[model samples]
Target: MNAPAYAHPQATHTVPLGGARVAYLLVRSRRRSIGLEVGASGLTIRAPLRVSVAQIESALQEKAQWVLDKLAASALRVQQTPQVDWGQGAQLPYLGGLLTLQLHPAAPRGCELLAVGEGRWVLHVPLPVDALPASVRGQVHAWWLRHARLLLTQRLQRFAPDLGVQWRSLRLTNARTRWGSAKHDGGIMLNWRLLHFRLPVLDYVVVHELSHLRVMDHSPRFWAVVASVCPDYTRLRAELRQQPIPEWDL
Candidate 1:
C-alpha cells in the first residue's frame, strides 16, 4: 500500500552491510515483514512495530550484497544524471533529443511552443534574461508536463487498439520507482519524465502498460502480449533502464 504523503521516517540507523557501512531511515509500521527500499532518496527501511532492532539489522545483513550493490548503483545514477541548467540557452531533453531553451522576456507574457525541425525543438520562455532559475525551471517544467500528456495519450492510442485493449484514461505520474502501471479498469499511469527518452522508448512503455490490461501479471503470457506489439521490447526495455534521466530540482 502507498504510504500517506505526510508520513516520515521514525528513526535512522547505521549498519555494516557487506564491506560497506550504510545508513537508512527506519519507519515502523503495521506491516508483517521488514522492507528495504533504495531509491532517489537513498535507503529506507520499513519494519513492523513489534520487530526488534537486532532482527532488523540481521535482515539487513542477509541482504547485504544486494543492498550494497543497489546503493552503489543509485549513487552512480545520481552522479551520471545531469541537473537542468534552467538558463536562457540551456538544453532540455525531448523525444530522445535535446531542445534548446530561448528566453524571451520582452517578446511575450507566456511560453511559446515551437517546432523548428527534427531534434530542433525550441521552448521560448517569456522570462527576463536574468530571471531566477526557479522561475525558468517552473515555466519549462509546466510546458513539458503539458506536452507529455498529449504525446503520451497519442502513443497510448496508437498501440492500445493494436493490442486489443482500450485504455480508460491516461494519467501522467511523477513516480520515482516505476515507468508505468495499468489498472484492471484500463486506467494507465505513465511517468511524465519518460518524455526525456526517444519515441521508441516511450512507445515501449505504453505498450507494456497496455499489455498489462490483457494480462495483469508479468507472467510469460503477459510478456508475449507485450512482444506482440513491441517485438524489440527487450532492447527498448534495456535502453529505458540504462538511460539516465535529467534531474529536475524544481
Candidate 2:
C-alpha cells in the first residue's frame, strides 16, 4: 500500500535487492514517494518502513522507465560539465561561462557578495571558514540562479514580440519531471539548474515553453511551433534524453 502523505518520516532502513543493499530512505513532504534515486555512486530508494521488500521491488521495477529517463538526463548534465570538487575554489558553469570562487580575507562585518571583475566574484568574509561549505555554496548558487533568470527573461522578452505572447512571471525551482512549464495565465517555471547547460540547451528549453503559450499541449501543431523556433530541437531533445536527473537525495 502507498504510504501516508505528509506524515512524519519514519526511521531509515535497508533491504536486499539482488544481494545489493538498497536503502529505504524516509522523506517527509507533501506526498510520500517510494522510488529509486540515482547518485554518483549508485542508487538509494525511499519507502515507508512498513512496505514489504516485495512491494518495494515491484515499485522499483514499475518505476524503471522513470528511473531510466532521469538517470539518462543526469548523466548528460554531468558529462556536459567537467568534474568539480565540492569545496572551496571550485569552478561551476554559470550562464555559459565558468566562474571560479575566491575566498577573501576579513571584511567589515560579514560576507558581502559582489561581482569583482569579468571572472571573479568576491565573497567579502570576516574569516575563511565563516561561511563554510553549505553557506558559501548556497550563496554562489543563488547568484548563478539569479543571473540565469535575468538572462532567460531577456531572451523570453524577445519572443513575445514575434508571437504576441505575454509572459506574466517566471520562477526557478529544482523540478524533476520537466525542464520547463507554462501556466494558463502566461506564467512560466524553469529548473534553475538549466544554467549549468550550454546556451543551445537553454535556448531549446526557453523556446519549448514559449511555444506552449500558443499551443498548450505536445500535439503535432505544438511541436511544429517549437520546431519553427528551435530548428535543431530534435538534436537537443536527443542530448536531453541521454542525461538523467541527478538526484541530490532520495
Candidate 3:
C-alpha cells in the first residue's frame, strides 16, 4: 500500500505497518468498539470516547494486515478510476458513450442538447470559453439532475406496470454509497449520479428497487423478482460495479 500523501487535519496519529505508513482519521465517538474503514478517502478510525491512544494503536496493529490490504485495493481502484475534466472540449460518459462539451458564450446561460453523433454527443453550454471550471461543472451538474429526474420518471412509468408495482413518489438522491433505495411506503429515491450509466443499467436499478415493493429483503426470492423483469440483471449489476463514473465534487 502506498503511504498516504497527506492526512486530514483531524488525523490524530500515524502508525507504521510493515513498509507502509497509515495515517488514519481518529474519530472519538460513543461507539463500543473501534471501527476501521478503508474507502476512497483512505483510512478512518472510530473508537469510543474513553479509549486510550495506546489501546487504539493496539487495536489497529491487530488488524494491520487487513487494513493494509484494503488500502492497497482502494488505491488501485482510485488509480483505475477516471476523473471528470470540467473544461471546454472535455468529454464525459453519457448513455454508454461520450458527450463532448462545447462552450457557446452567445447562447443561454444553461446547457442545451446541441446534437448527437455516432456513439457521441454535443452539449452546448452557454458559457464563455474562459469560464471557470467550477462554474461549468455546476451548470452541467444541474442539467444532469434535471434530465435524471425526467428520464428516471419515464423509465419507472414504463416498467412499473409490467412489474405490477406502483411507485408513490420519486426523489433524486446524491448519496455517495448507495445507488437507489426504496421505502415501504412506495417512495423511491435514486442517485442522480446514475445518469453516468447506460439505460440498461439504469433500468436494472429501477427494477431492483421496484422489486423491493414485492420482496423487501435481498433474498433469493427478491432476486427472482428482479430476474423476472431484467433477465440480464446479474451481468448488469457487475457492470454497474466495475465501470467507473467520472469523479466530481458537485
Candidate 4:
C-alpha cells in the first residue's frame, strides 16, 4: 500500500539538540512511528501524519546526543576526504596503484597510458595548459567509463564460471550508496567507481554479487559461498568501505 500525495507532507525545521541548533527535513506520512536518519546531507525525520510538531521535537530532544555524534562524524569524514584535482600531475587510482595525469597538447588528441618505470604509470592527455578543469574532468570521465565497461565485462566472465553460475548480463551503475546488486534473473549491477579500488577489493564485490544468485539473502550459507572464493572477504569488504573515492563530480 502507498500513501496518497495529500497524506504525506514535507517541511524543514530547526530543533535544539543538546545546546546546539540543528536543522532537519520532516516528512509526515501514514506511518506507524517516527524515524530518525542521519546521513551525509544531515538529519531527516519521518513521522506519522497524526504526530504533532511539538511531539516530534520532543522525540528529537530524547535522541539529541546520538544526532550530534553522527553529525560530528559525518563532518569529520567530509573533512578527511580529498577532492580530485583535474590537471597535470594529478593522480587517479588504477588497479591498486596511482596513475599520474600528464597533459601533452602536441602528443595526440586522445588519452594514452604509458609505463614510465619502477611501477610508475602516466595517463597522457592531449589538451592545452589553459583547458578548463571541467573539460579535463569530462575527458577523463569519458575514458574511464569506456574502460570500465570493457574491463568489468572480462572480470564478470572470468569469475562467473569459476563460481558455477552463469550471469546473463552486466550493467555498470553510478549508484551513491551500494557497491553492487544481483537479480534473480542473473543480471548483476556493479558500480563503475569500483575501478578506484584494488583488484582484490573489486573481486570481492564481484564474487559477493554472484553468490547472491545462488542464495538470495545474506544467510550463513551465503557468507560461506563468499568466503569459499575469498578467504579474506572480511578485510576486502572493510577496504571497500574505508577507501576514499576521488571527487568524481565536476
Candidate with top TM-score is 1
Candidate 1 on 1-250: residue-level lDDT in tens? 5321211133277776665667677889777779887765567888999999999999989998788777777778879998888888998778888888898776555577678887778888988888899999998888788889989988988998899988999889997767899999989999999989999999999999999999986678999999988999999988887788898885
- lDDT assessment of candidate 1: 0.83
RMSD (CA, angstroms), candidate 3? 5.5
Q: Ten residues in a row with the worst lDDT in model 3?
A: 1-10
Query: What's model 2's lDDT at 64?
Result: 56
TM-score (all chains, Cα) for each model? 0.78, 0.59, 0.74, 0.73
Point out the higher-scoring one by TM-score: 1 or 2: 1
Runs with alpha carbons beyond 4 Å of true place in candidate 4: 1-74
Across 1-250, the per-residue lDDT of candidate 4 in tens digits comes to 4321111112278766776767777888777789886644577788999999999999989998888887776556657776888987888877787888888787556688788875567888888766788988887888788888888888888788878998899888986556899999999999898888998999999999999999876778999999988889999997886677776776
Write model 2 residue lDDT over 44-125, tens digit each, in one string. Answer: 5656657766776787766655655554545456566455443456666544455555555554444455675764444443
RMSD (Cα, Å) for all candidates, in order, is 6.3, 8.8, 5.5, 7.6
Better of 2 and 4 by TM-score: 4
Indicate the residue-level lDDT of 227 in model 1: 91
Sorted by TM-score, highest first, which candidate order results? 1, 3, 4, 2
Over 4 Å off in model 2, which ranges?
1-86, 105-131, 243-250
Structural RMSD, model 2 = 8.8
List candidate 3 segments past 4 Å from native. 1-72
